[model samples]
Target: MDDEPEVVEAELVEDDRLPAIAEDRSPAVLLAEEDPDAWLPPEAEEDVQAGIPKDTSRAYKGDMDRFAEWCETVGRRVMPAAPQTVTAYMSYLKRTPREKTGRPYGPNSMDRIIASIRSSHRAAGFEPPDTMGARKVVAGYREQLALAKDPAAQPRKATPADRRVLHQALARLDRTTLVGKRDAALMLLGHALASRGSELAPLDWPGSFTELPEGGFRVRVYRKKRKKWQNVEVLPDPELEMCTVTAVRDLVEALAREGHTSGPLFMRIDQWGYMGVEMTRNGEPIGDPTGRISVNGASDVVSRSIARTGLPGDWRSHSLRRGFVKSARDAGVDIVDIGRHGGWDDQSKALIGYVDEEDSSGERNPLAQIGKAAMKKRGDGGE
Candidate 1:
């Protein structure tokens, strides 16, 4: 992962061409001079040109293109989008409902779009003033929205009851058939692992998992967030018990039984055990090889399961993680212990934050008899 010294030197030299700013101050102008080809390392360059799966170059390019179009429409250059302009764009998105979907963009989507723009600017070796200050502005906007007294301003959280309904709905899905089995397995594994959509979407059989003894398997995960080496681990849960490891193994085995060993784990199944895509050209399925399941796909699975069983409250993929944490806490597991299992490094702090206020209150409750006896002890009626 080390960048060659020469490459670093060259990049620094190129960066020097940009306007000089005060050493203490962040740059305001983004310079788009460095060639995209030169940005990647030697190994990554190969992966990029070869069109390997999970390469985000296309997505980045798309973001850049969209930003370019936006800049043109606003009569501004990509280097310096004013803070007000950024705010206006966010406001526009909030008011303008999506054309086909009819849903206006939310804070999360707006944040991502701004993030994409910021990332693009940074990649191009330019610093934008608004980019540095956008997060604070967004925070302020959220605060204002929260205090506006609008019903939609306050977002609701998925409750434990809602999760129970979702689980019950998923349980009703018949797993005897291939599609049912696949869906069930996918749902179970996704929930058990608490994996992101992207992590599960690009899974390839035979490549990602190796069978282990004692009804377990070793699974290799490529964590995009880390941008480092792969994580390989043995899942030790019993297959019959529906533990996290078991759930994922069951899904992998289901796909394996159908003779699929070298493609995306979750795919649109067709006859003869062949997987198909929703859209294709020249009969070749266009799998989203970016290792990302569409947000719609994740939402649809959870929502359909909930709808079938008439579940209460909104159920989303994140419910799984929340449920796991809450369930663990209720089961008498220490927060630190639960945090470790959930891959959280700051388990103590997280535990403090996650604990229910009521739970802590019970711990602080004093025994009435003991307190009264202690208070009446020494210099009481006898003295």
Candidate 2:
């Protein structure tokens, strides 16, 4: 009887290259170069190369390099780190403190490192674990997180005093100035749209806004969350339409007033008054590097403005969204209608959550049914 041949696998694989697998029964897999049969499209290859951010790519590469070094120290090939070895490494990372920071790796940072390691393994086409088992582990982790107490969870509503303070902060700006006009417009649009910071960070001037019929304006929002363009009709509000319209008009006029019609709507203006549209050399607008600005920027802006205005703690960006919901409820608009306006697809429960029971039927008031009872008693007495 012939002996089964052992499989030999390579340690490292490059992009678009496949590792050679030995045909023999000894389960060792070999790493090989590009297989003509499994070719990826040029565009797909390019996308893969560019899928991760530059910084993220660097960090991933560094982690892999470190892992390779560790493998070398243990006199083992980098391709196959046994499950036990990987678990040990994970424990080491948890126990190890940063030499510079003197702190253990944060949970989020550790998660990212593990993710990078997994990606590296996938890139090399290594069969590490059963997919179903991995999924169960991930699901359990998420469940634990959901049950964990998070002190930083956002509040459901903002106090009225917070709004007053935020308004005062915004009031300090002189709308007559170009920067002031732009900031004012940004605040109103952000508040009204409840837009994430990233959504407004790259606002295009002439491309995004247009005049509409009936003295209204149409604003095109590039919703990053939906990855699609959304059209919003800004109908004139009888109460504040004039001022809002003026603010928008002022911003538009400022953009075209200086013969600059094709750049970022909100250009960063330094103290020297040098004005140009904000964009990267690739013609993409400068986006917030730390995603915090997009979601939390509005809150920060509102908070800072409030602090500057010296107002109390009732106003916030979230207050804007909450206020809109509250106002709609007070105006007798159906919850479904409000949800649609708020970009919620399945909002049945959410809408119900917003409706204050007391505000809805007035049945909670003891005196409300008392009048009918008194009339019934009088009729019975007469009989």
Candidate 3:
């Protein structure tokens, strides 16, 4: 069934900043911080706004708001902040424990905080402070933290949802049920597209996925980090158990039957296996016209779906994307091709790190090749 067209337009934030700015706070400052168009000249605003994702802009604004509060508290300037003020602020953040973890902020968190400060300064048309000293403090703290073996400083990676795990998880899904159909589609398409939860959450039906004559689908994803739309090609999966195209097609048809022809491709399914709804003031029920699964909600779907199969691993939505990297590498796809498919920047450190980790041992290792040669020599009695 061709679920034909309707188009729609659409952060690693793990830290608690200072308390929210009071409602009585300066409206002008808030407006300027929240909307660049409020302060920036019209000619410069569009380009600057287009460069950053909405989520990022929101995050940077929040960071600046908190910084403004900190400035108020300390009687320091928020915009055109002196290097000393930023340094002091970084020092303050270092000592402050996060509300959830009750632990000091992570190194990456510190870097992001500094970036937000720099961004706020730039947004206000002020030259960014030379944060060399503040950065050094973070660098020193990171080293000391590493030496102490703090888990906070360590990079965490999701366990890749390899073919075995994916097959097992897919087999357990009851495609007959709406919830099951959604889960199956979410996992398969997520892996095929190598998409982030943020990227997948905003996908709209019929518009996002285009049917190719040759087979599979061409998915248009607005990659958040890159701040651009990229077309991703998902090849046809012959394996019935893990066929991404088939799963998506089935889910779309099922949702179409439920009178949900548009809006988010993946949406919340209620407990009774019904699509979600939002009631209006007069008690009229309107189906979730614009609601899409949240990033966390999407991750939970992946985790719960895997859990149903009794797989022993910590899986998250990112596992599907990471798995695509590993799977493609195993299939002898080039690193460059994998990055392009996965929305990773060419020569991305994170992407290269995955490849390096994959090749760290076994036949991919140079030492392993030497060892194999030695084994052959020993078997031939040639020393």
Candidate 4:
């Protein structure tokens, strides 16, 4: 027999250009991490901590920590940092590629990192560094990306999970499995509510979600964009198989059988079908056993559901929200109504952009219509 060709697998090598965490941290971060009593009394500390949302607070801390580590490597002061040092940091972040993605930080991400650095300085009772230079550099970076025709220059939009995708995903799901039931509920609720993964992750059964006297349910959610709570109604769909209420009902009943009455509406499940529990890895707790699934987990549900649906374009958690908007717009739903249901300000440019883009395609396109009219005239020998 002929010798088979040697098969070799390609492995991704870690990008050494990516910065590493340093042992030393900024003095302000050290003070913040050491002890709350050292800075403020217990009562005052509690009030101070409550001022910022938990997610924002965690993000700020993480960003600052990374900045502090970078400062240590460069032998620069993080707190009371000079504008030049800040500019240097921004430049470094812009040029350095991430180990996993092999891409430099995008402009929006860099902006948030800069904001975090400023917040850390303000919290430490120091004047924030002047970032005019850094801002200009970021603007120049955007221009460079535009010149290079880099897709990163534009915002990445998720593929909308239209009816076809939803139908395929729903049909393929094994409703008998616990994971399948949960995935069904997650996908339905995500699409019906037009909710972000972050908003959907913290739902508490019978607390945030409640049954209505009329069919379907009412879900009260805190809109992060609006910084206020909004009540949204979900009516039963005409199609029983695609109804959000039915999906939720089935998932809740299945969960009750497992002795989980209330907590996070969506939760993690293991390969063996056991619900996620308090667990540790490397002596650090993985996640709160009493808490619901993480934002990423909610996204995973959407992605997993649609993976085998043979759809085109990139899909993620945001796909459900975008899908709702696109589907509603296609049905000739008013832009204002769509924005209201989606928890977006009626005047929001982001929301309007979606509507405007959808309006420009197919028969709605002015150029396309003109082309068709000209063709008809030519065919009639009138041109």
Compared with the true structure, all predictions reach lDDT values of: 0.52, 0.53, 0.75, 0.75
Off by over 4 Å in 4: 1-45, 353-359, 366-383
Give candidate 4's total backbone clashes. 0
The alpha-carbon root-mean-square deviation between model 1 and the true structure, to one decimal in Å, is 9.0
Error (Å) of candidate 2 at residue 178 is: 2.0
In the range 22-74, model 2's lDDT, one tens digit per residue, is 33411122333333344345576566655544345555666667666655676
Q: TM-scores across all candidates? A: 0.62, 0.57, 0.79, 0.78
For each of the candidates, the C-alpha root-mean-square deviation to the true structure, in angstroms, is 9.0, 11.3, 7.2, 10.1
**For model 2, what is the alpha-carbon lDDT of residue 294?**
40
Mind giving the per-residue lDDT tens digits that candidate 3 earns over 277-381? 453557775544565777777888888988888877668888888788888887879999999888889878778866646555676688998989999999999
**Candidate 2 TM-score to native:** 0.57
How does candidate 2 score on lDDT? 0.53
Please say which candidate is ahead in lDDT: 1 or 4: 4
lDDT tens digits by residue: candidate 4, 1-383: 00011111111111121122234554344556666544545576466656665555655666677887888899997667899988998899899998979999877667767777776665554567899999877888888898999987766677788656788899999998889999988888888888877778778787887788987899998776567898999999888879999999899899989988877788888778888765679998887667467777777777778987777666777778888887787887888898999899867987876664767889879999999999999999985
Clashes of each: 3, 15, 0, 0
Instruction: Tell me the TM-score of model 4.
Output: 0.78
lDDT of 3 at 5: 11
